[model samples]
Target: MRLIDADKALEKISKMIDYCEKDTSVNGLTALFQVGDAIMDCKTVDAGLVKRGKWKFTGTDKNGDVYQCSNCELKIGLDYETNYCPNCGAKMDLEEPE
Candidate 1:
């Protein structure tokens, strides 16, 4: 899955439509429909800061001591540690223990 700016894509597609409108040929009609299909497959880019941080061991709770996501402060269980935060899409890592 790729992300793209929908507004920019739409602007380009609008130009294509304008050109196709002025040429009224079979190729122009085909290009117009192709642009429509492209629009249908487009996905807008997510708007926000791209977060990346490591899990920090904060404090203990009822579920035993847990780590907090540095980006979103979400508490995660030791059993649920992963490469990414479930809540904020932040990439997470842990320091090696000696």
Candidate 2:
């Protein structure tokens, strides 16, 4: 799974929605709008999770090779190996380096 910052994701999704609105093609607009809606929902849920203390916002390296929990600083390498930080039980929602 790919992780991203909630606010950034939301912003990107908004831009996608705007692009979709401007598109004249039915198929492309429909598909992009649907994908944007799904992404917005996921980002909203992630934000809620963070606010509830169930998840922590973290960052990944440039190559998306590493994830370090913001709450505990525990490093995670394998993307599919786990979902939560072992040290703090913080949900892993890692934003890629920009």
Candidate 3:
């Protein structure tokens, strides 16, 4: 398992915002804004995930999300870097991305 840098993630988010700014069409801008807003909101909410433990899984779902089983001693959800099962140290399975 590897750690992700918060700064890098934020930088990527900023780049997306910049792209949205350059969008001229309402359709494109609307889509970008919608997605960007969600991303931004999530980033704010999940900012502390970097401090948690993350285990990279070996598979991906149909949505192309990298399967991850977090061990953060909390519930598993999207944007989660921490998931801990109280039963043992053993966590849920994560399929590797193809």
The estimated TM-scores of all candidates read 0.40, 0.28, 0.25
User: Which of the predicted structures, 1 or 2, would earn the higher TM-score when compared with the native?
Assistant: 1
After superposition, which runs of candidate 2 have C-alpha atoms over 4 Å from their true positions?
26-98
Residue-level lDDT for 88 in candidate 1? 92
- Positional deviation of residue 33's Cα in model 1 after best superposition, in angstroms: 28
Tens-place lDDT per residue, model 1, 9-98, is 788788777877787774956996878776766776786766787888777788887988888888877765688999999877545568
lDDT of 2 by residue, 1-98 (tens): 55656777667767766866787565775766777666756643332344111233255666565655666766766454366667777655555558
True lDDT of residue 54, candidate 2 = 25
lDDT value for model 3: 0.51
Instruction: Give the winner by TM-score.
Output: 1
Clashes of each: 0, 0, 8
Worst 10 residues of 3 by lDDT: 43-52
Report the C-alpha displacement of residue 69, candidate 1, in angstroms. Answer: 0.8
lDDT of 3 by residue, 17-96 (tens): 67667875546657666655645554333333233333654455655544344554333324443354442454445444
lDDT of each: 0.77, 0.59, 0.51
User: Residue 86 error for model 3, in Å?
Assistant: 33
* Ranking 1 against 2 by lDDT, winner: 1
